[model samples]
Target: MYTEQGDPCKVLKLINSDIQSPQEGEVLVSMMAAPINPADINMIQGVYPVRPPLPAVAGNEGVGKVIAIGSGVQRLKTGDWVVPGHSGWGTWRTRALASESELIRVPSDVSMATLATMAVTTCTAFRMLKDFASLKEGDVVMQNGGNSGVGKALIQLAKHSGLQTVNVVRDRPDLDQLVTDLKSLGATHVISDAFLRSRDMKEFMKGLPAPKLACNCVGGKATADLLKYLADQGTMVTYGGMSKQPLFIPAGPLIFKDVNLRGFWMTKWNSIRSQEERQAMWDELCDLTRKGVLEAPKHRLVPLQNFEEAISKSMDSFTNEKQILSMGD
Candidate 1:
């Protein structure tokens, strides 16, 4: 837990706290696993929009088992696997006393990593693809940060829906391997940011139809490249700003192309949607996972006691694998 907003590795401290029994409409959950996401890190540093009160537990997403349920609880029972229905539930601890309304039970057959990690990245990807545009089979989608957790999820989900994705990644020493990895995930095309800007990009665009949807996680020049290739009247949804830079949109596309710009935040989406709607989405995603269509991103499982090491690795540059805190039973 942390008492102040600062570096996550510095401010976070592990401590033993007494376990609480479930009250009315509450359930006692034993956390199984939780992934450390970029939003979790930003929330730790007080940079994210959502901030729990100071001296609060640190994690925002994870999977847990319903060990006990209060008398009024009806939706969940003991042995049910669950994830937070919304963000900021303080999932870092081994156990949580949560209201029944705060949890969404999921299938136990899926892998722990996939269950723990899907609430954010996979949900975000699903929503962006489904809600943003009227994309049909064979329609093209373009996205930057192609190797990020959400990026990978989007690629796979799109492929399953018969949509094509043009993924953009930064140049790296292992660029070839990364390209192969993305292609293996069903990415239609994977190119470097530098390539997106080079003269060859014009020739490449001639071979494929313009993308109807462009998912922007990195802003600045990379986003500009997305806009440049977006189809007329196409939609570009900005879900994250990893570059920490303002978008530089050209006027021509906004005017002549009639391109639309929008933003999405899963937390906000959850807050406004009904429980049934949310459950339907979760059920669909879980079914996809069960069919082996949605696999967990690359990750390393760190014991919960060694959370500091996991946090350190999550903040390291060029680290591609996700850091997941595993709570052994």
Candidate 2:
């Protein structure tokens, strides 16, 4: 399958692309499902760091069924459902070819779309909460872009881990409905960007524990304000810069309060980790998913023929959110 790369006519064209047979330590796969995350589009525009060859089959993560396995490969076999890493396995087609090391075999019962997105966002959320911050019960974390794929994953994971969340979103005419929806999904305090301007915010936070960490996806003053709300020894991890502006970290948070600022990119870590470690992390995430603690990010399925409209919709995730694309039901 081939895809176009431009603003007005971003067409993901399907053609008779040959499926290269698996070499030693490689596998041949038939695509079952794929999730069209925002970073996938950014790569096509040359804005994101991890670039596949141009005119690429454009998808980051997806579940595939092994049709054939190379001689040296022992872990995966023909007919097994496996999910490859987010960098190279574009799942916008009838079949996929990938390395045996890149595949994470999943159980037959789990949804294929769930397997697709669990790689990047869910793993990032787990690392942020457990490895990065060491969040404890009763402690608080705050973030913006609360409806994003990563943001929604964080909300579910945090709730499962016995933590409280304060989510920030843009003001809308249906603000009350939005807050209610977020609360249902584990948000304790859902407020608009305008709410950040209130001088009494510190007072509003007086009753709750000071935020131990702030996860910023929406940058600029919104990020800085989240910093101002953190406790004396808190940390902040930034993953996205949707605003396309420089992130302004406030001096006082660093100088007096000792807040640590850091950035996270899933592709870098996924590339560096060994196969055993990657599979372990994925297994842990799957356990949570099996227990119903995590849910697949909202999906908008589109047929391979309607790739243009699907690309436009997924690119607009900042306002209207969707994930997962495949041949329609």
Candidate 3:
């Protein structure tokens, strides 16, 4: 990794990497694809968990092939495809070395991009639904930045679990188009911030349902607005700050409504689940995707060689879409 922000990230360029020939606990992998998520850049800027040592490789998650196996490794063969864990492996390169326990196996039918997208969003959404809110089917949820990767995943998961999502977004002139996009992705309801704040909006919401969960990725005023609509004893899970401000929750909601505000970060969340529980969740989620109940997120794949251009693209204006970094020729 480079020393400072905006610095180039060519920490190691071994002409030939030799992390292979794993010992009993380790496995060797030839990585295929990794998504460069906003969290990845946040790690690059020294604002994320799982920071490696200086001159260390940096990447959070990726899909790969088992090129070799360590001694006594019974779970994987030379041809298996796996997705590495949530911490650093520096997915920008060819080879990977990690313990067999670290890999999340995927079927041959799953695309590399799908594997890459599944880790953070799915893990966060799953925990947010099950752990934070103790969500029941027919309960409603609301979230800001609903067109985001995690937002889309949340939408599908909420629908599959017999829950509803009232997605919040900023007002745009082409907002109808955005609503249509989210609805097609299984959103139950979409409301602009302005529409949500008006007096008539509460009357409108009263006719359907009040959310038991408010998922906040955007902070500042957006988060405050969502809190207004939460039901009694509702929980709000804040995972991101696309708004760059600390979340502002009104005192009345917490006191009068008995709403609970919580936080979640995926890396630590995985530590709480048993291996079988993790695998079971993964299998069910993949089954849902395979059944067309969930679609893999939309992303622009950027080749690794164009790292600078990709960074620029990620920082560009007018993009509700996220990009994934790939090892394409």
Output the number of the lDDT-best candidate: 1
The residue pairs in collision within model 3 are: none
Give the lowest summed-lDDT range of ten residues in model 1.
Answer: 312-321
Error of 3 at 252 (Å): 0.8
**Which order, best to worst by TM-score?**
1, 2, 3
Question: Which candidate would rank higher by TM-score, 2 or 3?
Answer: 2
Compared with the true structure, all predictions reach lDDT values of 0.93, 0.78, 0.77
Any residue pairs clashing in model 2, and if so which? none
Task: Report backbone clashes per prediction.
Answer: 0, 0, 0
Ranking by lDDT: 1, 2, 3
TM-score attained by model 3: 0.91
Kindly list the per-residue Cα lDDT of model 2 for residues 1-329, writing each as its tens digit.
33445442344566676777889998988876777776777766667777677568777777778889887998999989888765855777777678887778887677766777777767888777876687889899998888777878889989998899988888788888878777777877887888876866778788799999889988988888889889888888999988877898878889999988988888888888787788888888888888998888777767666777777777663444564667442
Residues 79-164 of candidate 1 have per-residue lDDT tens digits of 99999998878888899999999999899999899989988989999999999999999999999999999999999999999998
Candidate 1 vs candidate 2, lDDT winner: 1
Assess the local accuracy of residue 110 in candidate 2 as a C-alpha lDDT between 0 and 100. Answer: 72
User: Cα miss at 327, model 1 (Å)?
Assistant: 1.2
lDDT preference between candidates 1 and 3, better one: 1
Of the pair 1 and 2, which is ahead by TM-score? Answer: 1
TM-score attained by model 2: 0.92
